[model samples]
Target: MKSMPLKLALVAGLGLAFAGATTYAPPASAQVYVTQVGVAPPPPRFERVPPPRYGYVWAPGYWRWDGYRHRHVWVSGYWVHGRPGYVWHPAYWDHAPGGWRFRNGYWAR
Candidate 1:
């Protein structure tokens, strides 16, 4: 019957709509706060930074803690789009009373 074809078209349209909705992901605005104690990370390593890009800021490299290996690992730096009226803060580790706290790189005024 003619109605069968009409119903199939409607179902196909709905399927495509739902498929795209499932793949949608929201943009991330902030980094998760992570902290550790006991073993402090080794001294920061010297990295030769490349020439700066016109419209991007270079984020310096830093050591990140590997929970499974139980040691600090080096994370390479990269460039990010420059935000107007904001400064990019590089990630770093700070020693405090309990342990070392990892501050995520963020855009700040």
Candidate 2:
């Protein structure tokens, strides 16, 4: 009979402890939004282009996102006219907390 009262008190104590924990919410400053990682794009595409013409350089192929299908599609590489003192930077995908972000390649001097 005495043990029964002790058991009841133990259970009540534990219940109150848990209830107290959930009753309070963390402050906004303490909350952090985390982005989920996403599946990466498929393998790269291969294309054979003829020799560069008119000082054009080959910009490598890259993946493009298709919003309609919610997937990535291969964009064929093509020849672009070379800038006098710029370098061709290819497009690439970058990892973000919630998903992937596509960074467009550009001509960097």
**Model 2 Cα lDDT, one tens digit per residue, 5-105:** 99999999999999897455332232222322266877787778777678677888888877778778889888776666666677777787778777766
Candidate 2: segments with Cα more than 4 A from true spot = 1-37
Error of 1 at 25 (Å): 14
Clashes of 2: 3
Per-residue lDDT tens digits for candidate 1, residues 7-66, read 999999999999898555444456747777678889888889999888788999999988
Clash pairs (backbone) in predicted model 2: 35-97, 35-98, 36-98
How far residue 49's Cα lies from its native spot in candidate 2, in Å, is 3.9
Scanning candidate 2 in windows of ten residues, the lowest lDDT window is 27-36
Give all candidates' CA lDDT scores.
Answer: 0.83, 0.71
Query: What ranges in model 1 sit over 4 Å off?
Result: 1-32
- lDDT value, residue 105 of candidate 2: 60
The TM-score, computed over Cα atoms with residue i paired to residue i, of candidate 2 is 0.59
TM-score of each: 0.69, 0.59
